[model samples]
Target: MRIGYFLSCEEYAPDQLIEQARLAQDAGFHGLWISDHFHPWNDAQGQSPFVWSIIGALSQAVRIPVTTAVTCPILRIHPAVIAQAAATSAVLHDGRFVLGVGTGEALNEHITGARWPFAEERLDMLEEAVDVMRQLWEGDFVTHHGRHYTVEQARIYTRPPAAPKVYVSAFGPRSVQVAARIGDGYISTQPDADLVKQFRQFGGGDKPAQGAFKGCYAATEDEGVRVAHRLWGTSGVPGELAQVLPSPRHFEQAAQLVTPEMTRESLPCGPDPAPYAEQLKTYADAGFDEVYVANIGPRYAEFIDMFRREFL
Candidate 1:
């Protein structure tokens, strides 16, 4: 399985993200996956730069392929606008960029003051948005009027040599079906064999299936768990709560119930590479073609070093 490093935009500045991309490449990571978020889960993790600007910089800073772990095109931005941004990104990356998209979370989309749609409606919007983007990427003037979006006489002038592959992110059966039908590949956070099987059976076939997980590498297990819980406890929030929470403050409130023990159970922690390797194997064994790992906290260089020596 190919391994990549995930750049958590919610926790790092633009320059730091670029630096980490460089470090990831130097450390022998096969590719890069960067989160595209308008806000951090909570104020404590603290940073969220415009993802497109960072992608532009990454084009010049690194040679490896890059993907937006996922971007939402239906809410805050028009599908036509996202098409243009993604087209530009593809060109900038020399066709090495993959546009991974999803229905998105209220934490990012609600900032536009738009009413957050229910999950089924959001999936419809995502499907329509993908259709709009694919049409725009064809480099021909296009006009489209769909349930959730519209585009008129739109075309991408700076198209890449080839259009970037669109990967759909899904966490449930319905969304998985949508991804199978509309996406060139599939993306998810979990390493569920059943999900992978479902995706393949529903038309994904041999297309890539990518998964991601978070880890915290510190000198001691306690130190690592402490940082992971402080920065990513929101990850332990159960069910579809992440999809509907309207703001970082709301997420912070919900995250209060997420204990450090829960965080440690969900994310691999500490200097011991054994747990990290074991966790990653779950993704590989689940039939994921690629897996991306995000390291929590400030010791990025050390984590990369350890990853290269012990995990890579």
Candidate 2:
């Protein structure tokens, strides 16, 4: 399985992201995964730069492929605009860009005061959004008036020779089925073998399925746990809270129930690269074609170095 580095926009500035991309490329990471978010999960996690701007900078920073670990086109941004942005991005990256999309979280998409829809409605909207984007990417004027969205006389002029692949990020069965039908690839954070099988069985066929996990590289496991808990405790937020929470304050409140032990158990933490490698092995066993890793705190450089020396 291919290993890539996930640049967490929720925790890094644009320059830091570029630097990490450079580090990951130098360390032989196969590709890059940069998140697209309007806000950090909580204040402790800190930063969320405009992802499209960062992607533009990344085109100049590295040669390996880059994907938006996941972008929500159903809300926050219109599918028409996202189509143009993605097209420009693909052109900038010389066709090495992939647009990984999902039904977004309220924490980011609620800024426009749109009521957060239920997961089923959101998935339906995602399907329509993907349809709209594919039409625009055909390089002709498009006018779409669907149940959830409307676009009039829209066309993407600046585009790569081929449209950027749309990889769907889905967590549930219905969403997975929609992803299999529409996505050129699959995206998930878990290494669930059954879900991977369902995706292929549903319609994904031989398309790539990507998996990811988070880890922290610290001098000690305890320190790693502390950092992970402080910065990304929300990673432990259970169920639909992550999908429904509307603000960082709400996420912070939910994160209070998460303990350091929970955080440590959920992700690879500490100085050893072995746990990280083992997690990758698990994804491989689960049938992932590619897997990415995100360093949960400030120790990303060390984590990337160890990966190069020990795992790459």
Candidate 3:
């Protein structure tokens, strides 16, 4: 199976980000998965750099392809802008850019004072946004009037040699159906055989699926668990932040529920390659062609090496 490294978006020096990408490439990682966020999930999380700029830098520094694990174009930015960014990045990377998108959360989506839509409405907006982006990227004059966006007399003259592939992040049935219908590929954190089958059933074709999992990588199992809790205990449970604040600092309040002990129980942080490889295999077993591993601690390069040595 092909493997990718999920670069941490939480606070880091800019040079560190570039260095991490370079290190991942040197370690034989196939691609890079990045996060898109205006703010870190919590104050303790520290930095959330502009991902596009980082991508631009990675285009020059690394030989591997890069994709935003998922960006919310409809909410944080317009589809036109996203299309342009993707096109530009693809050209810069010599056609190694993929676009992954989702409907997004109020935490990041509400920064523009826009009311967060219900799940169904958000899906509608996403569908329209994707269509608009695709139309604009075809290198033709475009005019679109839909429920969410309207574009007129615009064409992307600097289009890439090939259109960048669009991937959708789906965790629910309706979202999965949307992904199958609209996206070139699908992304999720967990491996679900049913979701893969559903994607094919809905005309998703034989495109790739990508999954992400988080934990700390260390020389000893105990150290890994301790670091995992320190870095990601706040995110241990699913659906806990369906209604949280707008900034990473706010996560600290909720993160109180996530203790070191809880993190050890919840995340796959161990010296043993067994757990890490097993977690990745769940996605592989479910037929994911690629699985991206997101390391939760400071030892980003070390985690990449661990995965490369044991699995790749």
Candidate 4:
């Protein structure tokens, strides 16, 4: 499987993200995945720069392909607007851009004060949203009047020769089927073979299915665990809470139930290549075409260097 680096928008500032993109390219990583977030999950993460502006900077910073590790076209931003932004990004990156999208979480989408829809409702909205985006990308005047959105006379003026590929992120079987039916590719954070197989069986065929995981690198295993638990104990937040929690405080409250051991058990940590090796193998065995690993703390330079020496 191709190994890439993931840029955590929730953790690093804009300049830092650009620097990491450059460093990742220098490390011989194949591509890049960037998170899009309105808030940092928790305040300790301490940053959430405008992702579009960062993407523009990244085009100058690195030659590696860039993908939004899932943007939500459903709520906070209208699909028409997202389509234009994505088209411009594709042009900026010389068509080395993929627009990875999902139904999104209340944590980011709730800020517009629109009522959070149930899972079934969100899935319905996502399908319509993608349809709208595809219409806008065609470069013709678009007038869409769908159930969840409406766009009139919208045309993307600055588009690449090809529309950016849309990769759908899905965790459940129903969502997987929807992704397979409408998505150009697939995205996931888990190494679940069942979900990958379902996407292929349901209609996705041999399109790319990218997977990712978070990791922490520090001076020692214990320090890595503490840093991870301190910064991203939210990773241990179970089930739909990640989708339902409306704010950082709610995540902070849910995180009390999570512990350092939970973080350690959940992700690869510390300096050893053994755990990182296992992570790569698991994603490969899970049938991922590409896998991206994200650093949870501040030691990203070391993480990329370690990958260059061992993983690359």
The TM-score values for the models, in the order shown, are 0.99, 0.99, 0.94, 0.99
List, residue by residue over 73-178, the lDDT tens digit for candidate 3.
8877989889989989999999889999998877778899887788889889999998988898899999988888888888888889889899999888899999
Candidate 1, residues 90-204: lDDT per residue as tens digits? 9999899999999999999988788999999999999999988988889899999777787878878999978889999999999999999999999999999998999999999
Residues 28-108, model 2: lDDT tens digits = 999999999999999987899999999999999999999998999998999999999999999999999999999989999
Model 4, runs deviating above 4 Å? none
What ranges in model 1 sit over 4 Å off?
none
Pairs with backbone N, CA or C atoms under 3 Å apart (clashes), candidate 2 = none
lDDT of 4 at 12: 97
- Lowest summed lDDT across 10 adjacent residues in model 4 is found at 259-268
Whole-model lDDT for model 4 versus the true structure? 0.93
Q: Cα lDDT of all candidates, in order?
A: 0.93, 0.93, 0.82, 0.93
Candidate 3, pairs of clashing residues = 11-47, 41-248, 42-248, 42-249, 43-248, 43-249
